[model samples]
Target: MSERIITPRNRGFLFLDAHPAGCTRLVNDMWRSVAARPAEVLGEDAPVALVIGSSSGYGLAATVAGLARAGIRGVGVSFEKAPTERRTGTAGWYRTAATAELAEQAGREMHFLNGDAFSDAMKDQVADLIEERFGRLDHLIYSVAAPRRTDPETGVTYASALKPIGATARTQTLVFDEDGKPDVREVSTEPADEDEIAQTVAVMGGTDWERWVSHLAGRGLLAQGFSTAALSYIGSPLTADIYRQGTIGAAKAHLERTARTLDARLGELCGGRAVTSVNGAAVTQSSTAIPGIALYTGLLRGVLGGDMVSPVDQLSELWDQLTGVRPLETDEEGRVRLDTWELTDKVQDAVAERWQAATTETITDLADLDWFRGSVRQLYGFSVPGVDYSASVETDVAWPASR
Candidate 1:
């Protein structure tokens, strides 16, 4: 049988050596999304686009929705590594490969460019590729995430830190056990210093998003009525300290501020708009590394009864809203709240009681730990349903011919 490795961590990453079984499951998941919400092309005048971080999570969903539903012919820029004989391919690689295959079947143009989205050269390359293939890009989706970033212009590197805003706080943190179930324990996190806060903002804030917009606009790359959106998260009050009020929160605040500013500028330049969408929490590779979010999400699944909303659902909904079909309802700051349902009083009141009552021993009774573990497992291409895990599998997944 093919093997995997899931190590336990308090606030560390869930590690695993993935098998080909996981890849097939992911491919099925992608198809399942399209099947569930069949894509209806935006129109003959649907915008040509550029999607950053377009291989996984929200980015991948947006790409699928754009091409399959909206008929957006554009380039996808991501920093995913290619798979080798000694290891199975990265999930993003397989997802992108699957996307290319699907796009080819539809006779749509879906080009994949693997590299750093923060670099000037990568930005220029994306612009050039879009010009070469389909000139005048209209839609832009910025969904990139990284632990560290080096400013391409000034050459300043900043690494993000996940710590609470105030004093060191102790709470139940989720980790994966050897049996691949949710393991909870009490852990404390130190507050971020001023420098750490600055660094976090530098890495995760809206500077890069602004840079991309300004560059694209300066070069006359953006189309009239161009629409751009970046993904952000503002969860329930339970995680406010660690997420919304933490360093990441400060960065998001900056991101929202930038979005509003860019929205005005985009209108001035070309009858365009820029807005930030607050997404729902799920067990992504990024969320698993955070301290309290995993346990909270697991408990949330219990509160909502096993039907947790996936990133694809959120992206698909957002796509429908932003395609000029349905008007977007926004706050005074012009931020779209896709997380509204996840934060309703009904959901939060239940989660609040569970959050206070949860412990390592009582957590399983309160939350569906198995589902949480499965969610994390799926991130690393393991624990997915309906794959032949016992059979010998191919390690090499080919890059798409279109790329």
Candidate 2:
């Protein structure tokens, strides 16, 4: 195949194509970041992890961190489109390929399953793999973020809504102007109906996480100290009405409840643990789509500057907790709060002050628009420091491991 330059094709927050080299660079950078940190030696008893939705964002970060920092090797499950001769693949596809390459370099065994993670067939396949390859499962990381899900049992598909719960929600959002600059815009959404709330919970809630644990336990594949973590978020006041208090918030609350139930269930079965890992806000593919998250994260980046904790940083901490290098810090509800810095009173006060004064004219000054743009672009494999976007490259790159 002839190498060709691949530039990003995007509209504001939605990207249509991904650069393979850019994605490869991103995976390498994440590996180097986690490798630089001090990690406890797990040696022969290293955990076997299964990272569902492990192609992008925190899932990908955790996969890389587990392998680079703790020598964890296991399987990952994600649903992504493969690249062909005429077009590019999804960003997650390229990212998984790059991660597989890194794992090979480090003498770690990493397998991948590219298909619907919400189906019974995928779960059964993973169970078979565990029995055949790893013998037992140590860690299961659930970081799935999809717009819709079809129940494997009933085949009923539920789509998640991002609207508020009771009253209408009005907030400031971010959009790109004609000059390709970030500008503040106002957005309002009506409250979601009861059905919408239920659907959102069905798709994004912890029911599936519980199902996976139950399935594994039924198959008797859990290790002596098996652990599971499901990723979640609780935004600040700026996005609380549309996020933490909205339809998705109801889903997250359900996820937390499931965690408590599973915590006890796992203890009885395998002396295991279960918890919701509430990650901090960052510019991810999922976050960029939420109504007010773009503006909120931009302002957050501006205020926190160098003190902000990144996805990889949080994943590193998760590895410590999973391996007994550090204790799991929890809120009153037993959910891990990784958004501590963002929720601090000082940070919230500064953000609120700036939020009130923010407008098109003051957007550049009030928020880290440049950083926001760079981060969004980076998610789809663009805006990296040394990548030559104008240079020729191949788009139909194959994932290192078979699906």
Candidate 3:
């Protein structure tokens, strides 16, 4: 067994290390899911594709699915911090490293670019790379999440906060004690003001996504019949005011609106399609930071009869839509509803009943708290079945060799 060093960061919400065994398990598990789920058809122009923010969460899963299922030549852009002696960087870094290594073994093109996805330089770099290598893109996926953004036009930075707008939202939240056991608790967040709402929209909105489409389309880098998507979430009513009706929701409204414009623009340019997909809520590092989401996801899982899909499965379904194996199912707003099951009336009714009755003491019984906690741990590369946590792990690891 190798030596291991793991320390909590961000109040135990995050950890820093590379448990080789754990990370290897995680990578292989995702790889298996990707390879297992087959796509309905191949891509165009040797299936050259690009994914912005493709290091973790939905983006990472979609990249893996592209390589293993869609047989695409993949290019991913991310801003993951590199590993150093003091820490092993983010789990996303490790995920990309492992994925790049696998792509090399399979003799396929998989380039993972580490930089700011929102930067103009990064966009130019991607255009240049695509022009020099494959010359065209067959698919694009945007799944970016940043805490703040400095608008290019205004030179002002805006940070997004999770809070209600019209009223104070009190909801059940999850907290972990020193022992790593989760306790459901209530948190109160006051309303966000006009400035706060605008800032949140600026940070999390679709300006950058629109920017990417304009650049790519103008440069003629996207191929004909290309399919593209951006991931968003509209959770159950348990925390609607704080999520779907709050600051983040306002940003999402912008995103969905942007999607409509992109859909038409892409169709004209290359007969392509673009839509913002409403994905189901799951345990992501970003989502965990939200106040009421943990409690909601917990109760959601229980209400849904213990069925929970990861980013892997969700993206695979998107792949199915892109490939025409499964037809698109859209809501009245014209947004794709890949979160088909989560939006079912049966599930929402059950969740509403459970959430109404759930207090801190009863939350554990009402929801899948154990699974929720485990999923959170899994995001940071802990709680895997075979990882020897006691053993020291290598902290200073090299980035994956040429993808």
**Most lDDT-accurate candidate:** 2
Ranking by lDDT: 2, 3, 1
Best by TM-score: 2
* lDDT (0 to 1) per candidate: 0.78, 0.89, 0.79
Report the alpha-carbon TM-score of model 2 versus the true structure: 0.97
Measured against the true structure, the TM-scores of the candidates, in listed sequence, are: 0.92, 0.97, 0.93
Position 378, candidate 3: lDDT:
77
Off by over 4 Å in 3: 1-3, 7-12, 16-20, 35-45
Pairs with steric clashes in candidate 2: 4-392, 4-393, 5-392
Q: List the residue pairs that clash in candidate 1.
A: none
lDDT for residue 349 in candidate 3, whole number 0-100? 89
Query: What TM-score should be assigned to candidate 1?
Result: 0.92
**Model 1 weakest 10-residue run by lDDT:** 2-11
lDDT value, candidate 2, whole model: 0.89
